[model samples]
Target: MIDRSDGQDEVAGIAVRIIKEGDRIADIVKNLLAFARDWKEEQGPALIQDILADSLGLVEKQILKDGIRFKTYISPDLPEIKARSQHIQQVFLNILSNARHALNQRFPGFHENKVLEIRSEVVEIEGRRYIRTTFYDRGVGIPGNIRDRICDPFFSSKPRGEGTGLGLSISHGITKDHSGRLWFDSVEGEYTKVMVDLPTVE
Candidate 1:
């Protein structure tokens, strides 16, 4: 039999856990609502770092639970870009989700090489400046045979019913709409690197 004080402590612990879980669920719902809404007409100056942080908050727990290491190196002075904040965040989330899937596919369990890295910096192209964000993952990468079709609508390597195949396609459209460029580099069974370049505010 436990002492009354011990029982009270246990109950308090359980109550705290329940409250924490409830708060987490609320946050997930909030993010989902934000993502599902139409932000097509709300373009403004947006900070890449803030968008990345919000996107990562949505999936960081799941990534950690999958036994994969996640890392980020965002430049301290990333310039603001003109964008629909929600749409840009969706792009970040999509890339992160793809990277997580690749890492999980390659390493079913915990492994040293199961890692994802995100880095951001400013780059120049044809005398113009752009913010370039990259996502690198050590996972089962794209095969040369189908590499060109990764962004094609309804093209997915995932098994039937597991993926709708429009993630990258939609992401590409969003980037292009924001005057940005999206591309990928990969070697089968090794790694995949995804890069997105969005023009900065003049």
Candidate 2:
């Protein structure tokens, strides 16, 4: 009877493992489908602040794990913009994740004043109104020489087996598709700031 009981336990464990693997596969498929969705003409006016909150929520745990302090200065009454919510969320998540990774790489563990700052405002450039969002990280800044190539596909500063280097490239593409602009400024060994500018509905 003991042997039979042990066999049953083994089978149950295998079943449980299989279920977990299946769940993981399902999640991967869902993410892939979201990524492959066409963003060219999916223009819908969405609350930009709400999208930012949702994106930050998704990565809050990971941000906390590295002892990185996230600060936001979003404008309370920012106007709605035409954009795909999912794609905007993706853009923010990718930026936040990269900031966390960079902080970890520089400090390894928790350090005082390791901060990630996010800010948004309504700005005008050449007579056009835009909602400008900025993400700033006090971590390892990109080298000036290669800063221009940071958005190139498959370009990564991470070590082998760590990053595919496609995060920023995808982000750049998504921002462009929304008729927006994405760029960054960095002073090596100091800080890096990424900015996204999107047109607001009149």
Candidate 3:
């Protein structure tokens, strides 16, 4: 009960909220429960165009601001995929930000120019087409031990308390819900590449 001295009774007004909340203390759940509920009910995957068109178009400014050179190799005629649009967007953004932060901003940097690449391809497996998308960064790579649990909740390389540590786990779940896969390969002093593959809509 935070004190409110302005003659306004917030506690009295919240009586209805408490009564409606029943046995659950919704106030205690800090994370984005609303978003999580929305995700849980997404059921099926999002349409490919809905996820890609807007996301790719929107990241240009952020990339330039971070001095990251972006390159794309998407097939012009690549087919659609199924996914949760917002979650998928989150996955991409998370990876992009991680790559940006990996850059040696103040120390001796990689002699090579900083670069990021995204490529999309459609390939057939068992007579069905699957869309394979990959994101690669020419920045510092992740260590193997941490990579093993990259999708584990509450596991993050970022400084303590700076990250919720749920982004990768959420992204992994979204990939699974779409009947797809997400993986990455990295070398500590080399580069990192993240791949996402989904069955193309038939």
The runs of at least 3 residues in candidate 1 whose Cα sits more than 4 Å from the true structure, single-residue gaps closed, are 1-39
Candidate 1 lDDT for residue 60 = 90
lDDT digits (tens) for residues 87-200 of candidate 1: 988899889988998999999999999889999999999999999999999899999999999999778898754566777887998899898999998999999999999999
Please give the CA lDDT of all the candidate structures: 0.89, 0.86, 0.71
Q: What are the per-model numbers of colliding residue pairs?
A: 0, 0, 2
lDDT of 3 by residue, 1-202 (tens): 9667544566666776677554233432544576667677554445554566567667768766666777778787666676567777777767666666665432234434677788878877678788877888867788877889989986778864346677678778777877888899899867889888889766
| TM-score of model number 1 | 0.81
- Per-residue lDDT value at 69 in model 3: 75
If both were scored by lDDT, which would come out higher, candidate 2 or candidate 3?
2
Best by lDDT: 1
Q: Which ten residues in a row have the lowest lDDT in candidate 3?
A: 103-112
Candidate 2 lDDT, 1-202, residue by residue in tens: 2469888999999999899767756765676577886544467988889999999888898789778998899888899999988888888988888888777877787788588999999999889899999999978988898898999987888875456677889899989988899999889888889999999998
In candidate 1, the residue pairs with backbone N, CA or C atoms under 3 Å apart (3 or more residues apart, or in different chains) clash, namely none
TM-scores vs. true structure, each candidate:
0.81, 0.81, 0.74
